[model samples]
Target chain A: MKEMFYNRPKPLHIKGRVYKFGDNINTDIIYPGKYLSITTEREEMARHCFETVYPEFLKIAEPGDIIVAGRNFGCGSSREQAATCLKYFGISAVVAESFARIFYRNAINLGLTVVIAPGISKKLEHNDIIEVDLKMGIIISKKNREELKTIRLPSSVLEILSAGGLVPYLRKKLGVEQ
Target chain B: MPTIAEKILARAAKRDQVKTNEIVMAKVDVAMSHENADVVIRAFKEIGLKKVWDPERIVIIFDHRIPAESEKSAATHKRIREFVKTQNIKYFYDMREGICHQVLAEFGHCRPGEILVGTDSHTTTHGAFGTFAAGIGGTEMAGVWSTGEIWFKVPESMKITVHGKFKEFISAKDLILFIIGQLGSDGADYMAVEFHGSTISEMTIASRMVLSNLSMEMGAKVAFILPDEKTISFVRERTKKEFTAVLPDRDAQYARSLDVDAASLRSQIACPHAVDNVKKVREVSGLKINQALIGSCTNGRLEDLKVAASIIEGKNVHPDVRLLIIPASRRIYLDATKAGYIETLVKAGGLVLNPGCGPCLGAHQGLLAAGERCIATTNRNFQGRMGSSDAEVYLASPATVAFSAIKGEITEPC
Candidate 1:
């Protein structure tokens, strides 16, 4: 078992296609308040994910895709549903300039990696295959065969990602029964 | 050497001082959600998370947009039913239950000296019970759902002392609004505000809940009243649970201490675009309103409803103004109905909405159109926060909102 929650010194390689977005992507836009009562099934939620913000998101999203967005992504309501819907759809990670405090914490706690990459959203395009080297803070696009950018993660958040999430990480560190 | 919030957080995390911006993993004693469970479940599957760290620690309430206002909302609730069953999450409350904050308090979910986080901003309501509670985003909630632990930054502290006795019709709501008005919306930004002094000690738990619930409107990360006899009695009556008292050390320091003289305060209003844009009701008198809403976790208590009923008895709402009254919870609703408060309000031309968020979130019922103006008891009046971006929301006390409804404009309770 992992003894503590700490990010690996070496990068975890991520291979995925990118899904681009604009600023102020709120929880209501991610998973509209209207569909909040629907089932938690992955298929059910993935269908409605971004249904309002980008009506064609469901049709275009492929497994192992990445969502790149502008600042203040997930700005309203601490609805964990926004993160859940994205994870349900098999998205690999979310890279944005900034995120609402609660949404940022929720994403990391659930074991879904979210990186803060300032200005990367402006350079990215939909369906752009990229490799994210989290440890190294580097993004390399396979489509263009070029280095897109590098973004750093705070040491604390890196620890969370390394530990797989708060529960397992804390369990190991506290020596508690899991 | 830890700050007060740090000490409590450390006890929960079993650590010493959790430094600023440091991610210290700690178990979540309580995780509350509202009307957003479907997306949370979907996140669970995406990560292939199988079980909650602790099901009993989780609370899923369908309060926002309740009554399945639309076909889409209905479908969301349907999804929640299935998720709750499959997970056996025992704390789930259906639409008929009530708002999460009120229900949580009534059901003994909030306890003193514990750390709590909700997916709703009004989660600060738990602080009235003396817990350190704040709101977080859905993704972070998903993280808590999986691991039951969250990160934190030990915040600085601010002590707000309310001295003097309140005049007639002045309430805890007025006191809080007055404080925000003086300090500005971001006055206590990212700080823990501890409410102290004799007047704070005299307030009922319901009234204290109103005070802490709106602390978020002023951008406070945490707001709590000191645990006292009233708090003890409330916990004892509600949960039969015993707790050791937690108080700040006499020598403990605060970033600043704000002294509010309640005796000199009148009912106040937080104007549009910002909660800190406060003015005395008399200062804003004659500002006509199209609606008056009294509800939200902030002021939806039986006491609040009773106050409104008292002012509206035998007096109809302004014919030009639409008045909406909603209790914070179904229990409060039923109690108000049983006591004839609901009838009194209805007879006085107030529309009684079933217990839920209602107009507070601007989803259904009582939303204002462009150029409309309303006096509300709910927290937050940011631009377009209530309905159309062009509409204006003036935040005030339940009494003030009721009085305004009758007068058709902002007015002092004479």
Candidate 2:
């Protein structure tokens, strides 16, 4: 079989409104266990996304909004609902000081862009327009033009993200079309 | 030089060796999910794949919210059953099987030197079998179900050595809680913790799982023990398959090493709000509690039930306290019942629940009310973990939970 999908990394350029949260923002608070049994539909999960912290979030959230949080973002539980809810709500990307390991992997596999910029939490303000440049590993406060450097991801990960997650990447590489 | 984690990952990746911080696409020997497998099934569907990469390598168990607590859950379970059948997957366990992690180990799905992933944080429990087992998310699990290969960044190893003898009432839960208190929640963040020394080698298979399970609370990606004689005997008795033990090199490199004098450690407990907030049982002896629970993937095995039964054998639970006992698996429930542990607990005013993770995640059963306090053997004490966010949860060993039920307070086991 001829290789259809090659390991070609594509740089991402994301511009969105910002939503700020604090450190140790756990999954239970993001999507409670009570809702785990109820439903996992994107709309249903997005309705309750961050319902514990910001009950009015989904009502006010616009597509391409960015979520900025302090260290240990997405801590607690290994539920992919956390990433799925955000992706379904049309979140452009998530920039955090750090993320729990499982959540980081989950976000990548689900095609949700996550950027780690040290001290990015201190520079972000609620409702600020943030521009994420994956090629340069820079996240800028568009209004203030404040630039924050992000850790460059492995090329393989960037390829997967550009292909819209691992599943699609696998499909493309295997020469399978939906 | 590679640590035990690196060696195992290297082997799985078909590489001679792997270094710390290096990423490798390793083959998965076993991957699992519970009721949450519904999400995994969905993600796999979204993959546009006609079938799972290997049906036999995938295991799905229904343990959380068993017997379908609500119509929505029943529908989810129904979908999962259909997915299992459609995929021709053979490793499906219904609600009667018990907790997912316990079932995986009990049925010999976890083996030495293999890499495993599950959709539950306590999947770390299988590390007791010398496997590099860690928790992932449903989407990643779906990716594994599609490819049978997952990428991993070989983490730095934190070697924890526990030596000397433990006190009669001191269990693995106490030891792990003490270690977590010292290291704090982020102490082992994103690292692989290797447990060794005489204390670990001497513990039973069930006891060793306690250490690995709670290691997640400290933010460890995985916790493993080098396979030994106890491991061999446990696997041999439960499975007829021959196995090779995975051990660390004499000069295995570790990022850090911590020593614990097990004999000096006493009954430890984690107070409300934080798993790393530790206190001695004597310090909170008089603090009143509204409920006491003895179960979870952490400490719901036969050994734990026996200890709880021995403590509350002839005594009654406090009038103000409701004691709940849930066996981790059907096998354990049957063994405990056959040994009269279940009857003894029920006789002592305890309410026995079906074999499953009922109250641990607070999904259903034994939920706490506002301003209430609970002493439980389950891991994690986050707010609202059981029911109401206003309620407080204290984490302890099975013996402590049983004794506290009798005292109606957080009490030390006699």
Candidate 3:
């Protein structure tokens, strides 16, 4: 039997600088539909991610950086590229007050870590170093170690995320060798 | 006490009953994709899957970029065709077929009490048939393609009951737009909306389709119009499949309930930039428009086309405005042509395109330039939804769109 390498959640104290955004950060801004015919190449998409809204987003974005945003983050379209762009660019996780329904599903489907942490954005400042415990749903300020509570994901959703996404989870459940 | 959505979802999940907030693995009766099939195919391959769990349950439709607009699109079509052939997928519609939602409806792929998932957001249209249909991402679709099942968090139900009769020129489109405006865009976020009462019951299948289709406008996960004789007869004429009708129990709990007097509503519109930014037609009328489009899964049905044609018959499209007419499906297209609706539209200077989702996503045909404004019968008016980010798109009924096309600006239908 091939032992499955699961993305099991632990107290992932990811240390990263915060890149803050506002409410209703739509998918169109994240990944424009104009490029649907071009390609969904991760690097190319990452380059253009948030291009119209925040020019030079890719240039400013670094690996292991966290995205903090206000209400209804990822609020437009069911395109997985919104999640893919951020995940491909090595975004540690997206911590938002809330998320659009489809964007939330797409993010989870893509194995991109996103948490609903109400008022987390208000507590965050630009470039604030932060540590997030993925399993426990806690966000701590590395500067002051001040903790913020995030809405805990259901056990079922946690399983899918911790398995790296639905695909790996299904594969393991079906005993399909990768 | 189960809501209609819960009833269908529980049956699909093979459970006695499933409540709101519960998670369950439900077998999908149908999984759908359009030209986006290319994306799903790629994602499926990336997952290292060889064969889809059930080819018969998979449906691939080519409506987004039909007739191969570009080399990239043509190549994508070739890939989807090859995948369909190799997998022996049973349901596949080429460019000639109308929109995916229409195709699913005419083919009876989404029967009552069934579960359907698609890559397009408007997949919520199937909720008119009492099916638990919702959109998913291409990657998530690929996962369902592999597993034949997908996990769903049973959403809480919101009851929207409308009574009374409609005024002149009012349609399901107007009612839904009014509701969206009232509820705001995120009112029903992550919830199932159950539409009920006499007004909804009197609506035709196509009209009901508009209600369910635009439910997503308010962020509803799915919308249900409980199956009635109209639904049964419509499904019967389309397919002979025996299916159980799902209905909400009398005591079913709702997260919230809203009441609307349908008879009191007039023509409504959603203004620029957001689906929830709505205004009464008279309030924003005569705002010069450059184009008018009547189509999309939302309002491209034959009935909608008939309404547009009736208003535009013997009338020339405004010299300054361009009118684009797209049928939701080839069946609707052919029916409209036979009924002379197409010829009337053409004589009015309306350009009838092939039966596909043309220009709705701003992919091709009828794209707008900066500083231009358009009134579309389709749902969603989010900024840049039709073309240039600077262009404004307004959502309205077919009658409104056709009349506005003749006036060269937003106008109330006679």
Candidate 4:
């Protein structure tokens, strides 16, 4: 049993204060297009994230804050900065009813944690303490005693996440990034 | 039963079959990019690759920020040009070409059964040609450049069946907007949406382009309008290269299906800040607009220009509205000029801009100020998409936009 457990990775958990948003929060609303040509750095991209829709998002944002959003979160543009901005801003994870397809895949490719929990948006308030267990596929709302089940991530996605995004994963597979 | 996406993806994967949710390293037919090629270049350099896998299979068009809107854009374009020259890429188009998607189809790089990946989301527009096209991040695109292959999780298929004839002024744009409204933004999340039925069958290649372009709004991984006579004819005009068409199995299993009655649908507008926040044109008719734009990858084709010209001919644009017309490509621009569409539009007080994605993505051209509103033929209506966060954009068809440009407000054609 000890030998079998030696190689098992630890379960990943994220606990943070929630920053809530409404449905169909698109990539433009997350990272406006005007700044695309200017900001080439992830840290620079983080500064402009949600600056258009929520003007004070950057000012009030803190490390380990999680975004709780309604359905179709991150829709519209396929800009990966929308996810990168949040990730670099120290957002631990995004818990939403759903995510736009490209943005969801971009997040996974970037190793930014994203969780899908139906009705999770309505259950949490701004600044509510929430905990998410990626391995267990569950979310616990500290505001209330109620618990919510999250969509279990596919094993392939889990593999990519463990490898720290597609770039690093490809680096390893190509045997280049020593 | 396999869908068009599955068939193309399977061939690219070189596998007997693939199932939904299964990851496969499918080979790429073409890697497309725009001004964002600089970003891809940086990622490629980070991957420690001195040369791309295949120079012939990469397509770069300087459409998004053509003519270098600012110092930043100019620098990015310089880097992109340098990279293109050094790589000896043949399919690269300069600032005067047009939108990436439109140019790709016009030049015959996109064909049925081929797999295309790009750095822009609207890359899905190529699926009008029945290609397995999807958008990826810059890093992922860099991987494709290095390896000529990318991974895909086969998506569940959704069939959208359209029937009945469209009423006058109810173009393909209206039908797609209606579908997006019904499906919501995430309705087709992680799924391949296949447009089928009589309406799609009768659609021209340009009209089918409108449907596949806006399908991105519904969170589709890839959108498809299967090959038909119109498609084959269109492909024949562009390229002499032989290619095979991939079709969905007769009994292909779709996880979800929808029915659209085109006859009953009205002219629709996606209101401020959301593509799915759609309503019939009558609901907000006469609402004042300051700018009326009739162009973008979504509706900037020659057919769209002809429709707008037919509507605005022999009439002046409203004094309050700035009516801007931009054709999708230089070829379309020349064709429109040959057909007198540009003359009718300009004579009617419309400003004909250069043939590119001018001001569509809010990088330059006609950006609205605070408290202003625009009626555009562009795909997105997201908040701040056109300029100021306080400004609003209502998306409609070219006919609706032209009609509204005359009225300086949102209105359906009488």
Candidate 5:
């Protein structure tokens, strides 16, 4: 019942099997609103990730597995846990055709990886291993050896991610020494 | 050369000018958190700060799942209460208040051209007041609380121009639903949307709120309606804060310009599973409903309730249906009660609940059973939103919800 990621360093290399989902996958499905107050702990939130839909997701998904989905990946309500839960549930990165405004920022701010690839959901199958290189701007599918399309993140976003999230980025910018 | 958004962000960033997609650190005017305040508190502490950078600027509200439906939430609420007390955060509202957006408006916390950030997606509701508002994560909000600032990427603006008067019973809700249907959910992703034209100018506070509150459904970063005399009056009526009206430059560049003719729109319904899956009322009428909800930040204002009362005046709710009416805030509750809207609803067999977000997020209150269907005035009808995954929710206007409550089916408001 201890916190999970408080002391751990952020992961830099993201390569994992694809966990495929369809379009318009919302925050409710990502993290049910019912448990919003159950616990603020990220690990507790991970337990309820996709609790109703795909209830067995936590058991099926391995640490560092990638998630690929269709458009509007995290729509509905601005629950930050919607992105945090997936990251804590062991999803190394989420690659979607697009992300809802709030969810995209939350994922990037939390240092959880997210990529916009126009049609990665259709091109990639569930459990297909893939490597993500934001600098190289491509997700190479290991199974098919095909190069997937991905927009290289802008420098502003990269600056935040490099510092490992908005919290640490601010800590540095504000000159708050550890 | 700057649009309304560019102007607002530049002001917040303390710069003379800012352009589209430029990242800038903006000072926080208001930092708000509701049920997620506990999450923010946790993140704030993790940021190694025992004190919020600015106490008076922080607002905490206990709206979602209020009265502690679970032991965990009860403890969480206690922790938040302690944090609010110790942090000396003055603008704290307990379960007795209402939904965060409604409470903020009622207390006159959001002002035009001021930058505001909150923990709820519907924080965009403040955009109705012309505030440059957006929703962010708990950790990011904690950062704002600690540093009293947050970064924003100045979004290009999307202008939606509306004209013509609405037909009877075809309110702002229908017009917004129609607009959402025309442009899919991600239509305005990462953009600032500004409502314009004669139709928007003539709308009251509540109607404009419906347009701004639901703008998030189309993936907007923030939303706005230029502050006018009506906005000034509305804000002055609630608080003494002097307001600023932000006008878009004469040649404000809009990434896209879409027009909506309000006169030709119908009673629109966003069907089950997606908010943009909209259709005309006649297209999906007669679908039986197990419940009818008429409240939420989207349509829980006194004006919204008056329309519901008029529709069901002197009439009994259908025996097969359970109608739940909730006001958006305690002020609206008292106003509606004095106006006899609550009495009329109760006399008509509709159950009047406390002023809070009841069953809208499916966290607590009136949740539907498996295979049940509900027609509601609240926004968003995603699957499993109101309890059972098999249960379906249809989103419509308050008039439509009241009519459906009386008919036990999805009937057109007209």
Candidate 6:
């Protein structure tokens, strides 16, 4: 049988430039509630994803950019839009010291790579090219050629990311009868 | 053995009990979104998720920063509209719909014996209907979008039983504030609170929502009301969907149970910085106010607005106070307007804003300036929560807030 959503046999991989931030990067700042009325397209959202925290975010973000931040990233409301906005804007993954529970689940379910890399916020700089091996919990900056930083991931989460997210994984695991 | 929350989570994961810090996949019965739908849609594209797991279970509301308050907000709205169309997700409410929590309950998205996760902290409001609802972050919400499942840590249960009848001047808001004062901000961190007793049974669903909504301020993961007849009737009226009848077992265990005598309770206030810094209204009686706001997912219901209107009726707000009134939703706004409560509020020198999260989140409308003092009917008055970090917020019942607006100081209604 084909592997279901986010149910890859191996861990997922993410390579992107880093966008570092502090703790408590709330939903309001990520995708400010005020902008909900505008277009829902990824392009439009990508333009404004981090417009508040950093005005030049969209211009600087590459297709596979990653966000590295302090503890409690995505600390406000359960708006999936905060994670979605980052994804919409081409953020391949978010590596934070910690994440608000709901945001962590949303990112994973949506298939946006999310990892907890304690102290990554301090070592990474804006636009730093980094590669993450989800199964191995390893992050390496090709530009710096420094020793790889390792972050731990549970086997269960690795399975989900490998399957490409929940829906596909469930379809494979539970069968797509419905 | 596991608690109800743990039991439900285990069933979702097809497990017996989920240990702490173990990531277990489970389904999200409901996923609510405000103006930030665009971001979520974007995440879907980046992750290459095909579609929302269940579009019908998705409720997208436009509450915070309504009326396209700015060019940036207008862009956000456009993104949400596009996503809604693309996903073919139903249950979309525009800016006029009202706060997401109120609309979710009124429209019947929340029901008993289910786990509902929202993208807002006040999603706990759904507990009034006996559903296990909690807030999550956007990334977590994205996971719910793709798989419809999320993880949870089994929380220890704290049972709070409020018995007896509430005095005329004491409302549910005061009752919760009083509890917070006793428990402190981190009092119930990572715990589930079960509100029981005669008073809870006697209170209306709207009143119960006020209590549950503020549970987040106490750092609780979930605040729940045991299913009763009121819960049954509420669900029956809202949807034709079936729900499992959920109630605590006779021999169920609890971490602790505290009995609160409501009849002897007084109107209470939670001072600035911490919700646990609570005091009786009379204790802080003469403190002047720069603003008084009555609305939020917590206390912004028709019943709450009616109570506030009654207090401020035929009375002018204090010259020093800027009184603001925001209805919980469009339905509530219409009901209040039809009942002449809007006129009463306007006549009392109050400004009525559109039905949205608005001042409650300090995003738009009625945000206080530095060193300003505000008495609000909303939940949580933590430092820097409303506007400036120095701005002080005093939480109170709607009536008490309205009366304070009239007196320009925190005061109990006569």
* Ten residues in sequence with the least summed lDDT for candidate 5 chain B: B42-51
State residue B414's C-alpha deviation in candidate 5, in Å.
1.9
**Tens digit of lDDT per residue, candidate 1, span B231-328?**
87787778855555567767766888999898998888888756778888888889999999999888989999999999899999999999998899
> Of the candidates numbered 4 and 5, which has the greater TM-score value?
5
- True-vs-predicted CA distance for residue A63, candidate 6, Å: 20
* Total backbone collisions for each predicted model: 24, 0, 2, 0, 0, 59
Against the true chain A, what TM-score does chain A of candidate 6 give? 0.82
Worst 10 residues of 4 chain A by lDDT: A1-10
Which model, 1 or 3, shows the larger lDDT? Answer: 3
TM-score of chain B of each: 0.96, 0.98, 0.98, 0.99, 0.99, 0.96
Write model 4 residue lDDT over B1-414, tens digit each, in one string: 899888988999999999888888899989998887887787677666778999999999998877888988898889889999999987889988888889999999889989999888888898899988898887678778999988888999999999999998889999999999999888888889999999999998889989988998888889999998788888889998888989899999999999999999899999987888899999999899999999899999999999999999999999999999999999999999999999999999999988788877888899999999999999988888889989999999999999999988898976
Kindly list the per-residue Cα lDDT of model 6 for residues B261-283, writing each as its tens digit. Answer: 99999889888755678988888
When candidate 1 is compared with the true two-chain complex, its DockQ is: 0.23
Please provide TM-scores, in order, for all candidate models, with all chains considered together. Answer: 0.78, 0.95, 0.95, 0.95, 0.97, 0.76
DockQ for all models, in order?
0.23, 0.45, 0.46, 0.41, 0.63, 0.22
For candidate 6, give the lDDT: 0.77
Question: What is the lDDT for B213 in model 5?
Answer: 93
Question: How far is A154's C-alpha from truth in model 6 (Å)?
Answer: 5.6
Residue B166 C-alpha lDDT in model 4: 92
| TM-score for the A-chain in each candidate structure | 0.83, 0.89, 0.90, 0.90, 0.92, 0.82
Lowest-sum lDDT 10-residue window in model 6 chain A: A1-10
Clashing pairs in 4: none
lDDT score, candidate 1, position A71: 71
lDDT of each: 0.78, 0.87, 0.85, 0.87, 0.88, 0.77
Which ranges of candidate 2 are over 4 A from the true structure? A1-11, A53-62
Clashes of 3: 2
* Cα DockQ of the candidate 2 complex: 0.45
Model 5 per-residue lDDT tens digits across residues B1-414: 788889988988999999898789899889989978887887777676777899989999999887788888889889999998998999999999998998998888988889999999988888898899999888888888998988888998999999999999999999989988888899988889999999999999889999999998988888898889999888888877665768889899999989999988889999988999999999999999999999999999999999999999989999989999999999999999999999999999998888888999998899999999999999989888889989999999999999999999999987
